[model samples]
Target chain A: MFIKLAALTMLPVALVGGVVANSSVMIVEVDADDVHIIVPVPLSLAQVAVAFAPDEAKYIQMDSEVGEYLPYLARFVDELRAIPADAMLVEVIDGSDHVRVFKEDDVMRVQVDEGHGTKVNVRIPLASLAAMVDAYDEEENMFRASRLVGALRAAPSGDLVHVIDGDEEVHIRMW
Target chain B: MNRKLLSLAIGAAMLLAVGATAQAQDAGWIHIRVMEDEGTSVNVNLPMSLISVAMELAQKHAFDGDMDFGDEFDGHVRFGGRHDVEIDDLRRMWAELRDAGDADYVQVQGDDETVNIYRREDTVFIEVDEDGDDKVRLQVPFSVVDVLLEGEDNELNLVGALTEMANTNNGEILQVNDGDTTVRIWIDANPQG
Candidate 1:
């Protein structure tokens, strides 16, 4: 019965920017039942290390040889992996590898795989997602999951969500 | 008493009296008319002495600092002052500001318009832009700047000076002259309440 309800309430977001599908490395997918996150390990790891550099000049110097800062990058990744899945709104899978999670009853199962990419997949219940969305105020301007839900509720069928950046626009369609 | 000596004394006294009258005329007052886009106009009669006082107050408070006195100062200047200001005291205060800073300027922003007055390098630059569409710019030369800076002591006509500056710079007296809003600044020779 819960599975059927989850299927009915599922929200699928399709990223339309060319960067998301091609050049951009980060991807996050959220639905009523689960959440999936993926990133290129080396590129993301290098970026994390560069943020710790002392100053702008040092950051520039470290950018050319990002691999030299692997020890610092490893520590940062370990800290993120240490966070408990149950304590978070969405469960996070394995610390170093392709992370996967599944929602069974009230508990969520998570797994991490050591591969070229960092992937996190977690299961989330529909009721819990609704509760999270309900916490946001209607008048707030910041883009949040609640705003998306509100838009979805108010919009008719086949409405489009447009994300504008400067002159560029990325459109997401909802059915 | 010698008749010739008495006549000479009277002539000298008459010449002194005429010189004093001429001096009083040179120290003239300023009249300002501000018209808004809403068809509402405000007329302000400011004695040259009052302008000096306001300038001194602005300097003392360091009006350039992070204080938002745009509306208050605008209202005070647009309307007449309640008290009289000493011309000499204002001049002294202005001298201090001039020596301390290279320039002084005032910026007034309304709902959809902005007016900027910049005094720099012995020249005053006024720019008014409304709705980010229409813009009026003027540069007041040193000669007029000197007259304004030395208020109440010079023979310069305040209205004539400003009109000439606008004409010379190819700028309009009205800052914003659009259908939605019109802002005009006029200097008059006669005082009006």
Candidate 2:
């Protein structure tokens, strides 16, 4: 009987459109230094590292199309081979040869060991990026930015933290 | 009827107060519109190396103004590629621009005579006059390094103007593989008319 009465009371409210729903959005200010890479909106952290890092990264090239080595070319290739293929986002080689990664508008493809064996391929939809953010050209050390990924990274020398808002809001020190 | 209306109003006020209190506990920020002013606009692309140096100089011995301590400094540090700038960073940039552009435009003979030949955008202006005199004037177009800082300090606006003048056509803009990800800046020079 109590259940019936509660249902009846709620029925009038429901019919009268009294139910209200509000969504809350959180704005977070992340410090740049902690970020390893900052790509346009659609690009992920892995994509950013692949896209922006110096041509001679610890295991990646700086250029998106033409791969070049500035300082640590050979050792970088050796480190790539050391990583297990399955454990990595981009596949690994025989720990001897060099690999090159390339991307199109929405698709990212990797040529492993210089296309000797099974080349790893991954494609990120352009829609996922919302809109392209900013690209860093290693040829020039300056930064260009937009609303997407504003700055590449904050100065690691400085004390800055990343703010994340979700189930539990917190500050992450990327450095 | 009047009493009922008053009670309803009081209830509404109480609910508003509760909602505001709850929001204070929530993790969020309110982005306030801070600047909406216009000045001379010049687009220049200059050598980043020289600008960086000059900015460092300006930071050390630049203009000093009194500002209310409690006011909030709010503005975007816009980047096109991988650049970063901070509050402290502006001082350094100001110093660098002054140092780099100082020699480029002026050659001083002791204290009395100086030549001012500066470039703005793709255009260069040359003026000859005595030191620190209004008789020296040059107007040119140049793209400045994008540093959009705003607050009571006005440091960002002042430094941005200097960077825009210093970086103009110095061959700093780099070529990108795809047009998709290049850095673009839209300085909010006040609101559009």
Candidate 3:
């Protein structure tokens, strides 16, 4: 009876999630409503659970933000995606430091600024964004690098970070 | 007689100077862009036609590298011969290309679009556009081009290709793959070795 109940419960979840061909790489299809600040450490789920157990409040905030702005951001992301098709709004907790810009064709107009030491500017023209992304990949030695938040998540514990300097130097920082 | 000898000496020096200038003009610059799934990088001063021929040869001989030549163009010819042999020949051929009297810029097709690469012995320079040299400049500065030449996660593979244009860099959406350590790449250029 217990087995039957478990199977019945799992069946719907599996169907809803879609039967992914390979379970090794779990491809989660997150819509706008599911947006969240994801810490992309290469840690196992158990390790992640242990590390994040004390940060339940942080997770809650992320979830709430995702729930509220995901739809709007998704639509917004889609709209701007035509030109800068690969550009995305990475939901991040520390994005307070980033500047936001909106692009009209090749022109990028800065929309937001928190006055962080670094230009926390968002809203890049597709061309500039493409150039930046390309420079980052060549600098970081990756086929492609994610946005700044994704970079942060990848090396959460490391203070030494890599950034493209004037689209030339991949400056490695000790902090 | 002394003045006459001095004039002859000055003429000889001028002729030598002209010879040096002519020698400098022997090699022309070509722009080569190496684009991958992640992004595109513009390399300048490279003999575009020579590299284009090398790329053609690699395609014909199936030479494997960070940037695969086959998938670059629609009408590209596949490299069917031995990889090592063909790559060596192409490299040799590239070295032999004479740049004399050619335009300072030769546009070559990268893995994606046509890019101009300025070739130099130690570094390759790239500009955004022919005219906008002041606005954009990138040096082929990496010392480890080998990493770019050979990689399992390269764009040639299905996964990398699919994810090539998947995400944008405007600090918005983050695709957190809790698998491999994801490197945030800005430019799509071969790793310099």
Candidate 4:
């Protein structure tokens, strides 16, 4: 049951968040209308549960042609890790709504603010993102489970994503 | 009589100098220079004879090193991947190209990129020109590449490549310019290169 919930919540924030190297717990919080939910998932323990899942759901299959581009992708990811702090990668503004994507210190951040209490925030550690890409295995054409765990393990405690839509809110944090 | 003797001495000295230069041409040194706009630079020179001796010693010790060496190309070679042309196929293609004499082996042109691969004299050249100030120029001697493939099946011979590189004459082997950084590799008799 915990594995199913963890896997369900894992996809969006798998590429984000971090804390101390020792911090391995992820907290997911969601509040909507009259319902409030909070779940603290231990990443190390959750991964072990994931493995017991049936074979078909175990791994995502990658295209065979991706084998040739693995090296280039790795090199490109390495370059991404070197992006300087406070660098602005993207920005868009329309009336009162503005979307800004930038790097701050060790993490890349995406923030969308559209007046009132409606806002979205995402923070992804560059190192952990690089680790996520490193998880890919060319021979097997799927990401390695250990490296995926490593990506989350390497992240420093931080908010992976936060969303506020009038009365509804969803936030994912890792520590 | 003194003037005639001096003229003979000068001629003999010139002949000896020419002979020494020809000898140096047979065994040259390889050099690499990398300079970046960020103010970092590197210069390296390797003695071909030293490499030859080291390779010989390694071979005696049964050291193959297991470096793939790209197996090389006269035909299609994907390079640095599992799908690259096999060793035997490379050798076969090389043999055919060697006999076919110097000619353009491949040319790829796109709006933002261009690559020219060809053979001239005893050298095969691979040149790439990409947008945003990226470029590469590489020339590997036919002999050196052939030596690299002389190993047994599914293996590339690093020692043989070193030996051939030692024998080859002085010339530029490779150069790359990307944005503000430039890298150059060449060969000459100078250990200070």
Per-candidate TM-score, chain A:
0.19, 0.17, 0.25, 0.76
What tens digits encode model 2's per-residue C-alpha lDDT throughout B1-193?
A: 1232234334423222212222222321111111111221112211222222232222222312222111221112222222354555665654465456433544555576566676544444656454332232344443332333333232334334433443453412211111111111221111120
Task: State which candidate has the highest lDDT.
Answer: 4
Candidate 4 residue pairs that clash: A18-A155, A18-A156, A18-A157, A19-A155, A19-A156, A19-A157
Which pairs of residues collide in model 1? A94-A112, A97-A113, B37-B182
Two-way TM-score contest, 2 vs 4, winner: 4
Error of 3 at A131 (Å): 41
lDDT for each residue of candidate 4 in B1-193, tens digit (9 for 90 to 100): 1232234334423222222222232555555565666654545444444343333333323223333223221111122335466777877887888899989999999999898999999888878777766666666788888877765566555434534554574454445666666665555655456
Top-DockQ structure, candidate number: 2
The TM-score of candidate 1's chain A against the true chain A comes to: 0.19
lDDT (CA) per prediction: 0.37, 0.31, 0.30, 0.62
Chain B TM, cand. 1: 0.34
Sorted by lDDT, highest first, which candidate order results?
A: 4, 1, 2, 3
Residue B180, model 4, lDDT = 67
lDDT of 1 by residue, B25-140 (tens): 34333332334344434333333333433433442354444322233332112112332654455557656656665555678989987889877776667776767445555555
Write candidate 1's Cα lDDT for A1-175 as tens digits: 9997776566222222332233213222223224323323222233334456455422222232233233333332232233233322122222233333333333333433344433222333333334333433334322233233332333222213333333333333323
Q: Indicate the residue-level lDDT of A19 in model 1.
A: 23
TM-score of chain B of 2: 0.20
lDDT of 2: 0.31
Residue-wise C-alpha lDDT for candidate 2, range A25-138, written one tens digit per residue: 112333344543432222123334445655454132234322222112222223223323322122223334434343332333343333334332233222222222123334
Instruction: List ranges where model 1 is wrong by over 4 Å.
Output: A1-175, B1-90, B108-111, B132-134, B149-193
| Per-candidate fnat, comma-separated | 0.00, 0.00, 0.00, 0.00
